[model samples]
Target: MKLATLTLAATLVTGAAFAAEIAPSDVQFDEYGAVDQSLTGTPGNPEEGEKIMTNRGLGNCVACHEVSALDYAAFQGNVGPSLDGVADRWNEAELRGILVNAKKTYDGTVMPSYYRVDGFVRPGNAYTGKAADDSFGPLLTAQQVEDVVAFLGTLEYEE
Candidate 1:
């Protein structure tokens, strides 16, 4: 009986410590996880961001969501969450997590990683064994990711 009680106490204490390690707000995650950094500075231009959204060789954001206002093409995908009011829902760091690698934020996600390393399988061919490009290739450059983040910042809802 004493051993069982001690084990329970240890479990409870460990759980509490783990909980304390998390940030107070739901918006903050560690450098390796989702976080909030929207209030830091000016974001990217929506117009230039629009280009990334529609670009098939770069961001290809339309392949997973319907940013109707941004995507004029009819073949936009519907696999991921719609990006209509994402800016209102998430801050820059949060968006960065989803953009950089949605699976890091939510496991079992079909979204591919844009900036993360070692999370994907090795590719075969000319790009052979390169971490940057999966079977599809690198989604966007770091600058392009920043531009997309800036563009997403403009998607706030009118209150």
Candidate 2:
């Protein structure tokens, strides 16, 4: 009985320690899954997107996917496919959906949701946004996601 009680207590403590909550207002997507709607009407700035991807504290996309353009990016993650020619493979809508939540299209994928504000494990400390007690918020704002997508579009297969 004592062991069981100790185990349960440990579980609760661990869960709370990792349970970094998102801002109550941060829940942007009413739809928990694939976002079909184009969040941004205006085209995003590819240059800005590139910066976010490179920023370790922000998107830090290079941590998971390889991008040749970011030649100086260090410790590129090898889990996801390379982003060399992603534009050829997916359109803007498709890209947007993936950016919002890749799990909607490809379930069981390791890719984290860029715009999603829900369903996170160890979201880490609240990095940005206005929230109480430093609770976390969306990894990237809607505009940021669009910008990253724009930059990704610049990557195309060379003949």
Per-residue alpha-carbon lDDT of candidate 2 for residues 26-137, written as tens digits (9 for 90 to 100): 3333354434444554457999999999998989989989998788998888898999889998877677778877887788998987776645555445543434344545
TM-score of each: 0.64, 0.68
Stretches off by above 4 angstroms in model 2 are: 1-36, 121-135
Clashes of each: 1, 0
The Cα error of candidate 2 at residue 136, in Å, is 3.5
After TM-score superposition, the amount by which residue 105's alpha carbon in candidate 1 deviates from its true location, in angstroms, is 0.7
TM-score of 2: 0.68
For residue 88, model 2's alpha carbon misses the true position, in angstroms, by 0.6
Estimate, for each residue in 1-159, the C-alpha lDDT of model 1 and write its tens digit: 999999999878755544432211222356556644432233446677778888887778898898756656678889988888989888778887787667767878888766554435555555444553344434665556667888888887656
Span of ten consecutive residues with least summed lDDT in model 2:
21-30
